[model samples]
Target: MTDPAKAARRARHDAIRAQVADEETEAAEAEAAENAATLDVSLHLRISHTLDAELRRRAAAEHIPTSALVRKLLAQAVRQHDACGLTAADVEEIARRVTREELHRSA
Candidate 1:
């Protein structure tokens, strides 16, 4: 009940679609691999138990890993021009302000 030429054309179209999808998936995986390769740096640090608990609490509150929270804070610190001039109190103030800002922004 179907025309042979029409059936053949449909088959070809389906095959082409499948091939394109496969190629796209392959390209995406390759791009992810390349990105992961570039971001493969590790850092380790030792801090007081108090700081560790605080970091874990903040990370949990933000629904991110502790490492991610630390990275975000460090990134913000790195961007500050007066970071070298910061005292302990100044650092605490900055951390509080950043935490508030992050919460407000996410809200």
Candidate 2:
């Protein structure tokens, strides 16, 4: 028979492992969907080293792939541009707010 304390600890570990596995499976499915939807969507962008570093850092902090982060940012940019022809200042402000919100959610 399992010892009570060990049994409780094992239960917690098992629960966490199961949850992580479920999350991983969901993420994989979502990624597959994202890939299947992109057709001739190849984009090559050149940016300053600083920007690249920041993007990599932010993506890591959010626990998402850099390509996924870039896709999300591009989608937001397109929507904002179409909605109002957003100026540089408007885009910058919106980006800052969005970054904060994303980081807060991750936290």
The number of the candidate with the highest TM-score is: 2
- True-vs-predicted CA distance for residue 11, candidate 2, Å: 1.1
Q: What root-mean-square deviation over C-alphas does model 1 reach?
A: 15.5
In candidate 2, residue 88 scores what lDDT?
98
* Cα misplacement distance, residue 62 of candidate 2 (Å): 5.4
What digit string (tens of lDDT, one per residue) describes model 1 on residues 1-107?
46998899999999999997876676566556655765756888789999999999997686555766787798788878555777899999999999999999999
lDDT of the candidates, in the order given: 0.80, 0.85
Q: Residue 54 deviation, candidate 1, in Å?
A: 0.3
RMSD of 2: 15.8
Q: Give every collision pair in model 2.
A: none
Supply candidate 1's per-residue lDDT for 87: 89
Question: Clashing residue pairs, candidate 1?
Answer: none
TM-score of each: 0.41, 0.59
